[model samples]
Target: MSSTTHNHTDASCIFCKIIAGSIPSMKLFETDKVYAFLDIGPIAPKHCLVIPKWHGAKITDIPDDYLMEIAPALKRIAIASGEENYNLLANAGTIAHQVVMHLHWHFIPKPDEKQGLGVGWPATKPEKKELQRIYDELKQKL
Candidate 1:
């Protein structure tokens, strides 16, 4: 991690304090763009959080550096979880039940014979033409 001082606002955000070194954590790894730490509350064995060094509520709001840092940090978490396969999850809006209001990816290791985190599967049915139209719109923007 670079020796850059971050300007974090202390607004009752655990992640902000974690980045600021104001809160104690079982640190796993740290980099200029992200932090890897054990989840105080774990949904699965060896669950950890891969949080951006900066605070942002949603994935779309995250800066490029933060987005780029995720894969490497996730690798570190996987190692901590005994290199077992893991699920990388991010809850994005109120409907998703994002509690912290900070963008953080959960690295939950799936060891063996356990049904991991469950999620609802919402079906979106559209015609081929509609799909093509949506793709075209996105491609045009890109």
Candidate 2:
């Protein structure tokens, strides 16, 4: 982890306050490993956040156990939201516009075509040579 990343600011952190029960939330479900709560500022009607119990500034900073807990919690939220589809988003860093320092997953449920999370995909595709270069570069890091 980088030194610039503030691991957590418990007393001032909104997520920490939520986990501490100091902040009220529309509780959906929870486990020893995770907590699922309705998004106070929801993009969709059933938009919610699935967060690990342990505090971490970013996804890369979270422990393996906490990371592992996300999948099942996401599944539960999807079913509870009564949606067959969902959009999972995790904003990582300052450039990505991660307003909250705590690591969390946005599970935006979309039951209907019009009333759900709207996603925008880039139209451009990288050239084959560029793709190969990227693949090689990533593999080298591994």
Q: Clashing pairs in model 2?
A: none
lDDT of 1 by residue, 15-134 (tens): 888777778898888888888888988877788888887777898887787789898888766765674567889999889889998898998876655645665688999999999999
Model 2 residue 74 CA deviation (Å) reads 0.4
> What would the per-residue lDDT of candidate 2 be over residues 41-124, giving only the tens digit for each residue?
987788999887777778777779778989989887787768777798888887986889888899987767786677788788
Which window of ten consecutive residues has the lowest lDDT sum in model 1?
A: 1-10
Tell me the whole-model lDDT of each prediction, alpha carbons only: 0.79, 0.79
Off by over 4 Å in 2: 1-9
Candidate 2 lDDT for residue 18: 79
**Model 1 lDDT vs. the true structure?**
0.79
lDDT of residue 109 for candidate 1 = 72
